[model samples]
Target: MGIQRRRSWRFILLFFPLLVFLPLLFSVSELHRNSKELDQDLGSKRSNKFDHIVLGPAAGEGLSNRLQCSGLEALNKTHLSHISHAFNCSEIISFVTVFAVYNSSQSDEKLSDLVTVGNNSYSKAARSMAILNTYINFIQVSMPKSNVIVLSDPASELLIRRNNVSLLHIQGDYSRGMLMLQRIKSYIAFLETRYEEHLQGKHHLNHYIFTDSDMAVVDGLCDMFHKYPDFHLALTFRNNKDQPLNSGFIAVRGTPDGLQKAKIFLQEVLEAYSSKYMKASRMLGDQLALYWVIKSHPSFDVKRFSRPEAFMNEIHGAQVLFLPCAIYNWTPPEGAGQFHGMPLDVKVVHFKGSRKRLMLESWNFFSSSGSDISDMLCLILKSGRTKYDF
Candidate 1:
């Protein structure tokens, strides 16, 4: 009996060590697999480059792909304002044209062919171009994403694919004279339909931003998000005729409820737009709709600024830290064209129509009175991070 007991004991001792090491062995194997997966991802990112990357000579030309684009100083700063405000954003959409007429110049049936974006839709194209351009620049320096949404089917899909950004198409029968709804209603419908998919996209990130294709991002809004995650993602409201809040740029909590609310508001607001008071709003149809809709929902806190510095404007100040106007209407006389010969301090150049032309001209003209980044560097070395850079 003693001999049998000893034999059993000896067997237990031998096998116990193997049992103890089993979890450790599996853990090491799992960790190795995870590490390998991570390595493959990093390798893929390294090889993939932006296709339409346009790094101007003045804007960190030849800098690493991660470098901040545009002439905006790459310094991060305090963005938290009073909690009274929330993140401002708008519909992730596009329009055929502001004009009433419809054209058959293009067809999605020919996906293989190069679709020419006609200049007749110049205003819409320019505005959308600015939005897309800003989106690319924002991704380079800030939170880059693989998915992007463009209203309707665009030929830009191939270009976006080459750049490694996934294109999401917003569908609509924008063919012709339909009286059931107008431009704003169509946009609302698209968001409502796609909201669920958008919410599910959080498998990759926590936040999602939707802006009117007209608005250009000048600086990284990441600062705002970092400061306030719980804050409602709202937008700057416009109270005046010239200075109005654009719902074009919007930030949401990336939830089904938020998407539902946005759609609900858009639908309810269309009726408001169709109302006599809204029609009287004349030039500001969407603004009128938003102003009234916002009033209805106290939960959504939308902010409006009266000055050039609030969101983005042409009003240049020699002493304040400017975000280089994410979205500025630069149609001549009203601060049109680029601020020529101005210091490289301007982070972005928003071209608004004739104003856009002016800004591009001014960009050539917006020269330094001789003090370039070299002089600025000398000054930075002499001083440190201070209001002096303003």
Candidate 2:
């Protein structure tokens, strides 16, 4: 028995040294693999000049983000500085977003039935085309990259000039653009499916830019993103104080974990939106769900800040006649009939619930030159008079 015990102790002592170094060896191997993979990817991108794609919805007044992507792929002459001080890269890798819900054509003669959202009739496609044109024109003239990837349904079409652009349509017996709050459940579910495919060890995108069709990209997003060589996330501000979760404009890292988190959020958001039987279940639908997502899980890292200025209109300043400006929705203050002379500092304006301020005259681009910008401002001032009962 003493001999057997000594034999066992000897074997254990002999294996302890091997075990101590085994973990260290494994760690070193994994680190080497990761380093090699990153280096190889960098080499590939450098060798091929640059390879990136853009995703956009075919619906909405302007597939603004997509067009901006296209333009960046085509133009952008300046080899600008880093995206931030941390990550180092030439420019943004891709623009991935949902399909737009607007029409491609905006010709006055060929246009007909406008999709009625609330009060006024909106010429669905043309508005989008106008928005798209602005972005494409800017990027194509400025940054021009490699390609674009757009996601949409069958009823949607992907229009891209030159091999520089590409469109990808996705449908699952669900009408995304037309769906309201109740039907929006499926729209959220579809995001999960797409995320799975995006992470299949295939095209490892650098960033995932998520934008709804209703939103527009007026500025050079890629040029702005280039500074963030290896950016973590880029999300725009949400003005909805009523709802805590704002899902309007979001940008995230193109990593497995980030993508999965988005799926989880969308799933929860859809579930919450679908629970209309419980009153609060329909808590602001998408926006409300987004609010909950931030509250529940802190991973979203949501960025909140006003575009140009933080305080343009206060809560007390919101009314029928004394309206703040086009930046906020709802009627204005009775004393104030127009918004032209109003002190306003805003880069992008959003019209929620209320449909009173949309211009009757079709002008989607809103003029780049400040010369026409005043006239554009005046036109908005005139439209501020109309109010929607619904």
Candidate 3:
């Protein structure tokens, strides 16, 4: 019994320490492993490559494939405004206006392929060429310091190169609805490239304006950022409740944080294709998508800018301002009774639908001291086109 008791005492002394320390050892191991995992998560996020978001099975047919073609696998989302704190933006400021123009083949059946001129239908390519030239003329005369980037096909290479404009060749099947929707993805990709360039010390940009080719800019846009430093996104409202906004004119800051937020908003807009408004917005293009996304925000008011003609709202912790279409994106009415010359306050003129003819007329009436404008007129006239006769 004595021997047994001595053996039991020895066993208790030896095993008790192990029993007490084993749990602590396991806990420390778990904590270290967890810390390592957390560090990895933070490290990946700090990279900010925007690769966390993956498009799974979605209703937007060929969206994933098209995005892949644009060298973008995914885009990260920013739910907090404080995310901007992580960006080390450069002090230099520059502005760029982007236009996505796809020169479709003559055999294509898209509505944009054929524009009606009175009783006769003419190829839209001529109009596209003419309008693009005139737009460049206006930009050179109005905002000579701003950069012009055109996302177009190979056919536009000579025109873009000749004008000293930066041309980014785009690839993908721009069929059916993709013609309108794919441009959004292209915009995001261009921004991503620009951001990467900034990191490499090759470029520094401030404001990025994405607009349609048919629009004419009569005033500068860079001052807008100075006017509203807090607002990250600005768009125009049509004053119609059904189609409250037009997606043609969109301005976003080019900083890292601003770019991220803009990407988030545009990504949400792309995802709206699966929403209920898809069918209604089919004929209207991206307006319904823009409306749905804006409405989906936690704090969005359709009438917020009704009285002020311009209003700002905080969405996803970022300020999104809305300007009246009449002021920023003015579209001329159909009849001559409502028609008058471009107003002094109008910053951009939208030659939407049949009003493309009016663009020629307006350009003729508008005068500028810039020699480029005069040269553009000569070119249009040399084509033997008066009143857009094909």
Candidate 4:
């Protein structure tokens, strides 16, 4: 009886505190659950109220940390010097962002629908400019020393002038297939002009990145050149089977030999764009042109054994490197989860089609002055407003 009594006493002692605190713990847990529910309700309300703009998945996670401008030197292990090294300040690659603000007719015809976000209705031109402004702002903050060029028509020039982004005036119907061909011609001419200056010792080796205006750069690009130093041209590919290559983002090395190689590869692409497939109007866009050129190459064979697997083939004596679209030219769906890698590792985000609104929203959300988004858009969309310095 004594032993049993002692055992019972020990059991009571062991469970006494739990008995006393069990109700308190449950009450605290319920309180927390209620608080979490309230926060979610508030968040949903805010989202509906600001449905005017598209927000990134990381809107609340703070995108300022993803800028990566401050970590350039540390990441590249170079002082960003203007010397003869890769990605030098002087021999830097120029980033080319293209947009079509007006049609070929020179009338006030709208190319895209006027997007009504919140209380403001933005014209196609205004939306294009706003996205371009976001891109320029990103480049200025992330790559101040690198050159940025805008390739568009005269109508676009006027809208672009407000931001002081370098303009490459192109004249023509700013439509799809036509614009793609014009981009090739204009880019070739620009390269030739720079090459001529290089012969006169007026320029160093030139390089360029052709990208869409609706894209944003989260990481510095020095690593790309350094990692793929051997290739003259690099193309990014999507997961689509029919139109796998994405021509929106291309990296070109402008050394004399590199230029020759790129010219050969691009010439093939240009010819393919005009081929019978394109004439049949079988959706033969630039992406299709790239696909045909790549697939038709004599040395093209799928070698799937390599790590970070990519397609590499010889094109008319030039080495062409094909990169995955996930890392280079990400076109993720709206409201998708976070990227696969670290945010700083994500080089570019192509906010194509309707997702262009996300660029504006992301800029506003990440900018130091978050509330100035409408004010900034007004400066672009309306007149008689002070220019917002990019």
Top candidate by lDDT: 4
Per-candidate TM equals 0.44, 0.45, 0.61, 0.64
Error of 4 at 192 (Å): 2.6
Give the residue spans of candidate 2 off by over 4 A.
1-89, 96-148, 155-165, 173-201, 222-235, 238-240, 276-284, 296-390
Q: Count clashing pairs, candidate 2.
A: 58
The lDDT of model 3 is 0.58
The candidate that wins on TM-score is: 4
Rank by lDDT, highest first. Answer: 4, 3, 2, 1
Tens digits of per-residue lDDT, candidate 1, 3-44, equal 999999999999999999999999999999999999999997
Ranking by TM-score: 4, 3, 2, 1
- Find the 10 residues in a row with the least total lDDT in model 2: 314-323
Tens digits of lDDT, candidate 3, 1-390 = 999999999999999999999999999999999999999999976554211112222111233311111121112211121113212232233334434445558565675556553334446555666667667766654565556777754434335543546777666434445556667667767777776776777866667778877777765555567778877778888656577788878888777777777777777777785455456433465778878888888667766645536778877665787877765776654211112222234456666664456565446434432323222222222221122322
RMSD of each: 26.7, 27.3, 24.1, 14.9
Candidate 2 lDDT by residue in tens digits, 252-321: 4456554555555455656665553234433345666545544454333323321222221111111001
Model 4: runs farther than 4 Å from truth? 1-91, 103-121, 154-159, 162-164, 170-173, 279-284, 302-311, 334-344, 369-390
Give the alpha carbon lDDT tens digit for every residue of 1-390 in model 4: 999999999999999999999999999999999999999999876454222442222221234433122211122112223122223444477888666665434332463445554344666446656777778876664566677887777655354453436777766556665776766666666666666676678877768888877777654667667777889888876556567677788888878777667766777877887773455332346677777888776777533212334566676777887876656776544212223322333456766654566566556644644422222222111111111111
